[model samples]
Structure formats: structure tokens, C-alpha cells
Target chain A: MTPPPAPVDDFDLHGYVDHQLPPARREEVATYLAANPEAAARVADYQSQNQALGAAFEGVLAEPVPPAMLTRRRPWLGAITRIAAALALLFTGGTAGWLAHDSLLAPSAIERTVAEPAAYAHRAFAGEFRHPVEIWGDNEPHLVTWLSSRLGMPVRPPDLNQAGYWLVGGRLLPARGGAAAQFMYQDDKGGRITLYVRTGIIGNSESRFQFFDQQGVRLVYWVDGPVGYALTGPVDREHLLHAAQLAYGQTKR
Target chain B: MDDIAQQISEQIPHLRRYARALARDRTRADDLVQDCLERAWSRLHLWQPGSNLKAWLFTILHNLHANQVRKLKRALDNVPLSESHLSASTPATQMQQLEVKGITDALQRLSEEQRAVVLLVGLEEMSYQEAAKVLDVPIGTVMSRLHRGRERVRQLLADQGQPVLRRVK
Candidate 1:
């Protein structure tokens, strides 16, 4: 016999079965269930199944734990510790190799000769405030002509508009070789970048980029054509490279 | 040592039972209980002196068990449903065998949220509010999931051609 369709009010049935209904509502559902024999039987089955399921898994709570698991450190901690140690070793090895290479190649000796103008440029602006540069960016043509004449070499201040920095000004300083030129630029965020140029006489003529940090300032030194250019700033390496690339591209054009 | 250890020791069995019900593995469940005990021992200051220590410990066990399940799921991507079955230590007796097996199988098929509601309400004998707190869900959600989970289990058992006993009003 097909039993009459169960008149299950989904929400009330849920609330009733879950014991969420108030005492008064609970009594109402109880009365309703009393009238429906088949539904009451189904509810009993549900209650029995729920009880049996709970009993089946409840014994697991009483079981004693082995000592090993209590003391076992998390695997991630060990893996991270090993990775940190390996990274420390790698950093040490790299530093040692760099020191060894520096001593063998003795780039410092060559740097001492070619980098005098860069140092002089650094000292010239070390404590300057309002008027660090001799010629302002407004007099670009005269500034370029004056710097070129003083250094005895063709010089052009790299246009940095594409790199989000506008030309600020230029300064001429005395160096080991002769006159050194410093051109400065400023980005929108008030970050100032300086480019130092001087005559190159060192036999090492190959173009190379070197990263160095002095105090809080970072510098990227490189040689292109005949000019020794040192890009210095407190900006990150990537940003400095981006600015340098823009400057270099403009100079070539 | 004796008094303090005894108090903690007493709660261990209940914690273990809840953990076992949650995890379904003896070793994993016990490990969860141990973690809970150790955590409770260290953070005993957070425990209200006369509050329900059993419930507090069960809450800790539940959180730990849930986290472990999440981590296991992440590690074992595309894991088969059958492999996640709870291996209960209960003997496979003929009388309760079908009911026990059917319930366990149905429980496994439930979503974690639904299973949590069923375990807390059906197994733990917790009220709707208490089960909601343990599962960290709304009381309404608890009721809804419990209702749905129970109906699903009935449907699943019925599909297995279990004898349908008539409801007694």
C-alpha cells in the first residue's frame, strides 16, 4: 500500500528534529507526529540510527595516546629549519667567493683610479641643500655645452622623462683625472638620483655593471662608450636600472 | 603531580572518544587528544576554574581535528572517497552490522560541515546552541544541516534496500 505522502514542512521538520523548536512548538510537533503513524516510525528510525552512529564512534574517545605523537615536532618546522641553514651556508659561500674574486681581479685598484671623480661628485653634494648644482635644468643647452667644454669630451645629460624622473640640475667637480660632471634628476616621490661621469684611463675598457651600497645609498656603476657613469640613489636596484636604461636610450638617440 | 595529572587524565578519555568520532582513526584521534591536553596544560590560565572543562577540551579537539582534515585534504588532492572511510574498532556483528555500516558509510558521504553537525548533535548529545558553538556556526545552520543530513542518511539506507519499519505515532 502506497502510504499517504508525508506532510513534511521542511523548516518545521528541521527545527522539530533538531530540538530547535520551543517547548510549546515541540508539543505541537509531537501532537502532529502522533496523528501521523508512518512519519512517527520514520522519526524513530532516524533516532535509532543517530544513536547507533554515535555509539559506534564514541569509544574512540577513551583510547590512550602513544607517547611518541605527543613529542613529535611538526614536519614543517624541521623542513623550514633545514632550508634556513642551507640559505645561510649559500650566502656565506657567495660572500667568500666574491671576496676572493675581488682580491684576485683587484678591481679596487682600477676603481681607485677611475672612480676619483665619482667620489669628488659625492663629496661636493654631501651637505648641499638649496643650491647643489651650478646650472639649473632650465638652462639645458648652456649646461651641456659648459660640462662638455670642462670635461674635454662630448657630454649629454640623459633625458629621463620616460623613466618618471625629470632633469634637476648639473654640477662640475675637480677629480683625479680632470673635471668630473654630476647631473641630478628627481622623481615624483621626491627621490633624487645622480649620474657621475669622468674620463676613463684604466686599461679595463669592457662595459660592466656593479652594485654597491654605501651608508644608506645604493650605486650602480657601469662604463658605456668612453664615459664612466655611476648611477647612485637610495632607490631600489630595479628602479635604478629602469632609470639608467631610459637615460642610456635617450643619450644614444 | 597526582592531583593535577588526575584531573587532566580524567578528561583524556572523553577527549579521545570525541577525537576518534571526528577523525575515525585510533592513532590520529589519540594524537589529537594529546595535542588538546598539552595545549590545555600550557594554557590552563585561560580556563575558567569551574567552567565545563570537558566542553573546552572538546572544542580544542574539534578545532585540531578540523585543521588536520583540511591539511590532509590539501595534501591528498583528488583523494578517492572510499579511502577516507573511518575504520571503527567495533566488531562487525550481524545484528547491528547493516545499521552500523550504513550509518558510517552515509556519515562519510556528508560534507565536513554536515558531518560536524551530526556528530555534535546526534553523537555528542549536545543541544542545538552547544552544537552550533562547537561547530562555530549559527544555530539555524546547525538545525538545517542536521535535518538535511538525517534525511540523506535515511534515503541512502533506504536505497540499500533496508527494511522500512512503519512509524508509530
Candidate 2:
């Protein structure tokens, strides 16, 4: 017996495997496969591959989430900033105390602008092939000093190599009450996540790790004293969330 | 909980299932799902009320998966996939020639787009249209990729040569 020529086109076969064919078209595929034992074997293989893929990770859903994963701890940068605040307090004795003290206080709600601007900046900048950032991270010392001087505070780009994100660079932008800095980070995979930080007065109390997704970009942001930081990515919410957490943690120190 | 929150919550198990299928490792999959949930919670306002929550969740998962695959691919670049020695060794399996390990190994070798296409269609049982939406690709692209992906998996499984109990055809 002679074997029939291979199905030159697989649109129908693929459609059949993916359940995309119309009823009549499905019948056509079935008829074609029946006469061709080779095609039938191929269908059988596709079916089994699907089964194996589906069954492969079935147990993962049932596994309990480790207790630690459900909760997050934020030291709020208490150690590093508090000590500096205390040292400054020792120098500025009484009259200037309240003013300096107020400056060190937790960021207020009105002062914290996280998701919208961050997402906005991500959309505006991250996709740009030419200029993703104004001051590239390669010029680390210069970038920090320039941004620090502009924001009227010492600014350091958050280190995120541990979290698999690297500081790519940053660009300055306008934000609520004052100037904002958007810091970009990229992984070896060429995926980019950005940290948007700004300083100014916000009237409301501090925000917890708030999240926002807009225009297909996801972000998580929070405000510490005198600084509002948001981590943005075009990736999924989870990735941005973790990247945000890492950014927050790294920036804290 | 608000309506959107409630709806988003209902999609978690399914999200976990999809993440697990995508990631293949238990810990990594759960981490992905958990991050997705927290992100979804914070971004609840972004989701249009009365929209398709499952599709939204799947989209989020796909984005996360894509990022991770890029990272993995970067790592794979350091130690080339060709050196993995997957082809020469096919582990014994009673059920069929290619078991979960072999299948997953083959999948890891496929391009991210191809993996997403097949898993969405095969594991999630999404229609070509739904899979296309999740993947942000056209229906024609989905079909072509699915065909290419399925064809590759077949070739890989055949090369792995797990002892199929019998060839039915």
C-alpha cells in the first residue's frame, strides 16, 4: 500500500485541533484524516500533547500557598532615614525642630501620586526606542546628582538586580505639586520596568502599596517621607507588584 | 467587598490554574498567581465594571509569563539550550512515551509566543478567538502559531522516543 502525500496545508488540521473549524469544515477535516492514517496519527499526537500539557501542572493549583507569601513587610525605611532625621534633630535644637521634623514625617495622601503618573510615564517613555530616559543610568553618579539637585534632596536610583531588574535610566517630568523623576529598569530579557518618584506636599495620609493598571501598563506605588515612588511595567500586575516592592525596599535604604 | 473585587476574587483559582500551566514549577506558579492577585486588587479601578474578568486575568498572567520567559531566555543565552541534552535522554513512562517532563522540556524550547498560543488553546481550552485576544494576536496568527507549535511538540515527542505502548493507527 502506498502512503498518501502529506496534507500540504494544515490550517484545517490546526483549526480542528484548536476547535476553530465550523461544523461543516470540521466534518471535512475528519473525512480527510480518516483516509490518511498518517494524518490521523498526527491528530492523535496533537490530542495527547494537549492532554499531557494540561495534566502536567494540574497539581500546582492544589498546593497551599506558603504562609509567608500572603503577607508583606515594609520597614518603611525607618532605620536609615530615622537615624539621619535624629542626627539632624541633634543639630537643629529647638526653633527649627518642628519644621525639620515635619519634613521627615510620613508622606500624605495628596503628596503621594503613584499609579496614574507612573503608568502615564511608562506609556510615554518605556516603548520609545530612541530615548527611553533623559539621564541614562550608565552615568550613575551624574544622574543621581542631577536628579537630587533638582528634587532638592539626595536621590539614588533604586538597585533592583536582586529582583532581576536593572536601573536603565530616568527622565524628569512634572507631577502634582512639583517635579518628578521616572527611573527605568531593564532585565536581561529586555523587559523594562520604571520607578517614578517625586517629592512634594500631599494632603492625605500615606498610601499602602497601592496598585493601578492603565493603558495596559500595571504599577504599584507608595509614598515614604518626602518621596512618592511607583514601579511601572507593561508586564502583568504580579511582576509590577514585586518589582514595586523591590523598588520600595531598595529605595528605603 | 465591592462588585469588582468580588468578581476579581472569583477568577483567582482559574488564574492559578493558568499560571501553574504556564510556569510548570509549583512555587514559581503560585508566586505568579499571588502577585497577579495583589496587583489586580490594587488596580481594581482600572477594570471596567461588567467586563470579562477571566480574560483580563489571563491577559495579566500572559504579561507576567512573557516577562519571565524573557528573563529565562536571557539565562538560557548564557548556557545555551542546545547543551541541555534533552534529545538524547527520554525517561521511562508507563502511560505514554513522552511524560510531563519530556512535554515540559519541549515546551521550554518553543518560543514564548508559540507556548502562549498552544497553552491558551490547549490547557485553557480557549477558542481561537479568545486565545487570540489573550495573546493580542490575530486569529490567523494564532492558528499558524498553534500549528507550528503543535507540530514542533509532535516532532520533539517523537525524537524523545518514550516507548508508546502501541501505535493505534
Candidate 3:
């Protein structure tokens, strides 16, 4: 005789189809499917849609990344160098000309410190089994004051609750010949993300926000005025950026 | 290539893949990728090191596509499905191909926002939250769009009424 089917009174079928359910919930979906043939068919149909979409677009990935996209940077820079070379040849009669390329390529001490430390500290402490943070987020004021004093600036733990993460805690980190601060947060889901804050690393200038994926962890970091921030998480890129944006907004304010 | 350039370059294939799904026209897709690459290259300094470059590129591509849609009064469409790729003459295989094309066509018929959520969540296999972040929308919006878009595709494909694999005995 067959056993009775499991109930899914509280399980989200949409979440199952979307594949966003956590493991145990996903298993619940699987169990639900085994009991109900119609629901199983619906899930199969959803899978086929995904399969069809994947198959159709699969060609695009095999096709070359279009040389134009790759070479976009070359033209303008090439044009400038060509023009400069032309002018030098015309004026100097075959003498080699200096292009000021060295200065442009060099990273300032502060710029070097900004991004590297955050990444380093993230990789180091993010995987810690215990003591992931030096100062827990329990006492917000103390964590802020302690990190701020160590970094020689008034730093505040950016409130990330809006972006679906609450402060798990923070840690003082050694980075780029200076002290940096790391604040951790977790969403209602088991997702964990951290904000790496380096203060007075650069002059008052704006920098672009960029993302990097190291191993499996995702990060997005930017520098603003004298503060550089990197938000790291083992979540998808969009989620990490959401946390990063929230942290930036909190710190900025 | 410099390390930064290499990292950025590595993301081009996936970017192209996403662009193709979004545009559904090879030339238009390539142009979108080109524009995205140019923007990324120019703003290279803005990208934070050790962060996700692929997500950044997708974000750029999504914004560009959104702006282009707005300007063109939303020409979001896909080329009609053709059986030209199918060489097999077996009736079963032909039916399979037809079903596949049916879903593809149905996907294109969705509204741009809904279609985007489907392609991102289905093809790219992004989490709902990731798609939301890329589209700059709330996760609830992503879920609704994905569910509706997916359900519509199923209806159009007759996945509920007509069995995709087996006929009613």
C-alpha cells in the first residue's frame, strides 16, 4: 500500500517553481510533487520552459563576444596616441616622444589601499568558523566608537535593514598598512554579507562602483570622498549590490 | 590584457548571451553589447576590485536596454520561430521542436518587464532577488512578473491542457 502524501499548506509553490526555496523547503516541494501528479506536471512544464529558453539562447554564448565590444577602449586611446605621435614626428623630426603613460598607470598609495584591503579582509574573516567579527553589533555605539577610533575617523555602522540584512556584528581588520572596519549582516534568509569600511584612504573624490566575484563570494565596492566601502557576500551579484547600496546610503548619511 | 581588462573581457560572453535574449536580433544584440562594453570601459575606475564584474555588466546592459525601449516606443519583440534548425524527420522529434519553439514564441509575446524577468530567472538562472537587483525592482515585483510570465508561457505552450511529452491515454 502507498503511504499518504505530505501537505504543503504553508509552502510557497511559486517559490518552488522559481527555485528560490531553501534546501529543506525545496525538499518539501519535491515531496509535494511525488504525491500530486498534477502539480508534478506543472513543475515539469515550468522546467521545460526554462529548458527551452536556455536551449534557444545557448547559441549566443558560443558566438564570439563581438570584437567591437572588446576593442571599444582601444580606439579613443589609440586615436589620442596616434595624434600625439603624429604631432611629435612633425615637430621633433623622428625623436621619440614621452606619452606620460607612467603617471596615468600608477596607483596612488591611497588608491592601492582602498580596494585591496577590503577584499583581503573579506576573504580572511568571511570564512571564519568562529570570531567572524571582533566587535559584535550588540552595542552599536561601542562598535562604532571602537572602529572609528582605530581608523582615526568617525565611522558608523551602516544600517542595512532596508536591504534585507540586519547587523550580525562587526570586526576590526588589518588592511593595507592600516586598520579597517568590517560590519556583518544577515537577512531573514540565511544569507550573510559584510561591509568593509576603510576610512581616509583616498582624497575627497568619487569613484565608480565595481563588482568582483572571487571564488564563490560576490563583492561590490566604491570609494567616496575619504571613505572606501566594499560589501561582500556569498549571494548573487544583485543581492550583494543591494546590500552595498544600502550600506553606502547609510554611511553617506 | 591587463588583469582588469581580462576580468572585464571574461564577462562578455554571458553579456552577449543576455543581450541576445533581450534583443532577439543578432545585430541589435551585438550593438547592445558593444554599447555596454564601451560604457563599462569608460567607467572602469568606477568598478570596485574583487567584486562581481558580471553583475555590473548586466546592470549596465539592462539600463541601456530599458532606455532604448523607452526611446523606440518599446520595440521589444522576437523573430518568429522557424523549424529550419530541425533536420530530423521523425514525428516525435518534430513535435518536440515545435513545442520548444512554441515556448520561445510565447516568451517573446510577454511584456518587456515580464519577459526580462523570465529570461533572467529562467535562462540566466538568476535568483529572484538577483533579477530584482538587476532590474532595480523589489523582489515581490520580480516574483509576480516571473510567476505571471511563466504561467503565460505554460498556457501558450498548452502545457496544462496538452501534455508536452505524452498524450492523454
- Indicate which candidate wins on TM-score: 2
1 or 3, which is superior by DockQ?
3
Q: Model 1 chain B: which ten-residue window has the lowest total lDDT?
A: B79-88
- What TM-score does model 2 achieve against the real structure? 0.50
Per-residue lDDT of model 2, residues A1-253, tens digit only: 9665445357777678767778876886888888899888887778787777666766655666555334432335534665566566557442222233333423222212544456567767776778888888899899999888777677788788876788888877876445778888877667777787766422223445755432233456676754678776656555566677777776763
Candidate number that wins on DockQ, 1 or 2? 2
Candidate 2 scores an iRMS of 11.7
The structural similarity of chain B in model 1 to the true chain B, as TM-score, is 0.75
Worst 10 residues of 3 chain B by lDDT: B73-82
Candidate 1 lDDT, A1-253, residue by residue in tens: 9664445565566567556677866777788888988778667766766666756775555455466333434446645654554455356543211112111112343344334335445545633668868899999999999988887667878988876778888988765535678988876755566788764332335565654432233456665544567776556546677777776666541
Sort by lDDT, best first.
Answer: 3, 2, 1
lDDT of 3 by residue, B1-169 (tens): 3887888788888888887777664555666777788778778779888776777788899998776555323111111111321221234655566654665567667888998898888888887777887898998898788878877887876753544432232
Instruction: Rank all candidate structures by their DockQ, best first, as comma-separated numbers.
Output: 2, 3, 1
DockQ score of each predicted structure, in the order shown? 0.10, 0.17, 0.16
Candidate 2 clashing pairs, residues 3+ apart or interchain? A109-A204, A110-A202, A110-A203, A110-A204, A111-A202, A238-B35, B97-B162
Number of the top-ranking candidate, with DockQ as the measure: 2
- The better candidate by TM-score, 1 or 2, is 2
